[model samples]
Target: MQKIGILGGGQLGRMLLQAAANYPVETYVLENDEQAPAAHLCHHFTKGDIKDYDAVYNFGRRLDALTIEIENVNVDALEALEKEGITVIPRPAVLRTIRNKALQKNYYTTHQIPTSEYILTHNIQELSEQTHFFPAVHKIAEGGYDGRGVQIIETEKDLSKGFDTLSVLEKMVNVEKEIALMIAISQTGEIAIYPPVQMVFDKALNLLDFQLCPAELPERTYWKAEAIALATVKNFNSPGIFAVELFVTPDGDVLVNETAPRVHNSGHHTIEAHYSSQFDMVWRILLNYPLGSTEAIMPSVMLNILGSEGHSGPACYEGLNEMLKIENAFFHLYGKKQTKPGRKMGHVTVISQERADLLYKANKIKHGLSVITKADGRSG
Candidate 1:
């Protein structure tokens, strides 16, 4: 059997493990937490730090291929394993570039890829001195994910709101809408780009609340976004799935926001909406097989289930059954043991050929679902 190892056993790893069950492969996962989402699902689970050189290196030594569900692992170990003939998806160098926002932005500039203008700051003191960058977004150079490590500085007063380390100050362009393009590149160099997903963010949480597939956009805007996404994958030149988020300005300009080199939240709807899901596509890429079709079988909408406010402890889904009452609505809970305000507990996807009906069902699902918990015999 082919042996595969994955780094960081979070929800992404959990879903990948679920998909890998269809194939004859022995899977192992290395995660610091024994209770991680994928810890019990894999054939072998190593409760160790994915960032430790020895832990990651030793884990890859016994596997035919190594891939990461999270990008914060030790790249040095991956490089060593790759040199010893073990396949490392997306390559270690690419990880090194993507893990740091400054380097990622520089790569875009060097490659002539269109992106928002940004300035790198080494410390909070330096960031405070750059007043011209007001009404900007601040992102830590490394270790940022989900809605963490990012801040909006609207004025001088907001300068005290960000990290005091290496960060990027980006001019917040006037955006008409945000969209994501999920692209897959196979090991043999074959590529497929999915239909654009229009996104709407939760202003309070700074996270994607829900998204619509086959984004309702003008033909020109659609084609330009597709071209930019394809160009990004070509520039990365790595095998695996990529989620490229873009900003569409009111003037019809599409600018690169950032890119993720793994299965992303934006593509979650694909599991129920597309001919081939991102999980299946990633597996194909790892095995160097020809990619599956990227066409959407029907229009779909995905909504995130976040932990309820004022509740933190053992988790529970409050209205899942009610939410499931909607036809074609699918729910996938990330096996998280606890719930805290704003934590990603799970997601629901609704699909239908009729755009209006699809959106109507998606809205019902969102309102019906709630992730709440009881702690110390109290709701909070």
Candidate 2:
């Protein structure tokens, strides 16, 4: 069996482990946490920080090929691994570009990809004097995820509240809807694209609240989103999954929002709804195998279950059985140790032929569900 190495061991790594089962391949996952989700499933679980050069270098040194579930890992190690005769899918150069938000935006500018207008902010005074100051979004150049490290500068009050840290300020364009295209590039330079999915965010933090696949978008916008996504992959010369997120502007234009160089939250719906899941896609792509057909097996709506306010401990799920009673509602729990406010604990994917109806049904059950607590003594 061919052995491959995986960096990071959150749910994406865990899901990849599940998918690699079909090929009966031996897998190794390097993770900082011993309680990481993929620990037991992988043939070898090396406990090490992904951002440490020695850890990443040692893991890649022994594998046939290496891939990552997250981009925050040490890129220098990937570059070293590339030099040490290890295959680093999607290429370290691409990962390095996407790892930092500033570098990512610069790549788009260089490639002539359409995106929202942005200005890099180095200090508080600089952020204050910006022309597009009001109603702009503030995003850190690195280490931001799941509603953290991002701020919408709707008012002067927001900027004064400590949201101005190493931020990139951009015009908050009018968006009709938020959408994402989950794409895969194989080592042989083959590509596979999943149907675009419309995302519904929690108004407060911009955290993904729910997503419906095959976004109810016009044919033109659909093709445009796909084109932008493909263009990004081509430019990167990557050989792994790329999740290209976009915004459908109110004026019927699809604008590139951002990109993830690895398995992403936007593509989580593919697990139950697609012919090939992202996990399987990643494994196959890393092995230089033929990519799977990126067809939607069923209409699906996925809901992200975030920890409610005033909660900060292990995850507690409610109404999971209730959702399961409704035909094909599948719940995925990301065995996280804490459930702090806005933390991603897990997600529930409700699949059915009648997508609209299923969405409403799932919403109802989701309302009954609470990853939160009702003044419980134990943190949920």
Candidate 3:
């Protein structure tokens, strides 16, 4: 069996390992926590920091191929591994560009990809000088993910909220709708694109609240999104699955928002709704197998299960029984033992033929299920 190692051991890694069961591959995970979500699922688990050059280098040298659950890993080590002939999915160069917000934006501009205009700043003083760029979004160049490391600078007064480190100040688009397209590319230059999905974020938390697959879009807008997403991934020129988040402006123009170079939350509903899940697609790419179908078996809505406010301790699920009784609902808990406010604990996917049914069930689950701490004796 071919051996593969994954960096980081969060829920993404856990789900990836779950999908690895069907393939003739031995899996390994390197993480700092011994009880990480993916630790027990893999054949081998090494407790080490994914950002440490030596730890990542040593762990990957023994594997036939390597991939990542998160982008904040040691890229230098991945570059070294690629030199040693161990396959690194998506290529280290791609990660280097995507991991930094400034570099990612510059790449978009350089490649002529449709994206919001942005200005790079090295520090707060540099940002203050660009007051005319107010009402923009300030994103730290590196180390930002899942709603963190981003702030909205509505005016000069809000500039203090901007990062003191290198960052990107992007002109916010007049967004009409947010969409995500998942694509998978193979080593031979073949590509497969999943239907674009409509995403709705929890504005307060800046995290994805729920998303509907096969997003309803005007024909022209849908085609535009598809073409732009394909171009973005094609330029990466690497073999791996990618999630391209985009914005649909009021004028019906589609612009690139960001891209994730691995299995993403936006495509999580694929586990039960599509012929080939994102997790399965990643495995196929890693193994050099023919790309699987991205066709949906049914229309679906995925709701994120987040920790309740004022809860922090051992995790507890309230109203889970009620949710379990609902038809066409699939629940996936990440096996995380602790609960903190706004933490992503699990997700529920509801699939149905009718859009009305999908929306009704999704709303019910959104308000019904709650992740809270057993110590608090309260549910959100």
Estimated TM-score per prediction?
0.97, 0.95, 0.98
lDDT of 1 at 374: 55
Off by over 4 Å in 1: 375-380
Candidate 1 per-residue lDDT, tens place, 126-237, comes to: 9988888788999999999898999999988998887799999999899998999999998888999999999989998898889999888899999999998888778887
lDDT of each: 0.89, 0.83, 0.93
Candidate 2 deviant stretches above 4 angstroms: 162-165, 373-380
lDDT score at residue 234, model 3, on the 0-100 scale: 91
In candidate 1, position 265 carries an lDDT of 93
Give the winner by TM-score: 1 or 2: 1
Q: Output the worst ten-in-a-row residue range by lDDT, candidate 3.
A: 371-380
Best-fitting candidate, measured by TM-score? 3
What TM-score would you give candidate 3 relative to the actual structure?
A: 0.98
Judged by whole-model lDDT over C-alpha atoms, candidate 2 comes out at 0.83
lDDT order, best first, reads 3, 1, 2
Clashes in model 3: which pairs?
none
lDDT of 3 by residue, 163-195 (tens): 999999998789999999999998877799999
lDDT of 3 at 318: 91
What total of clashing residue pairs does each candidate reach? Answer: 0, 1, 0
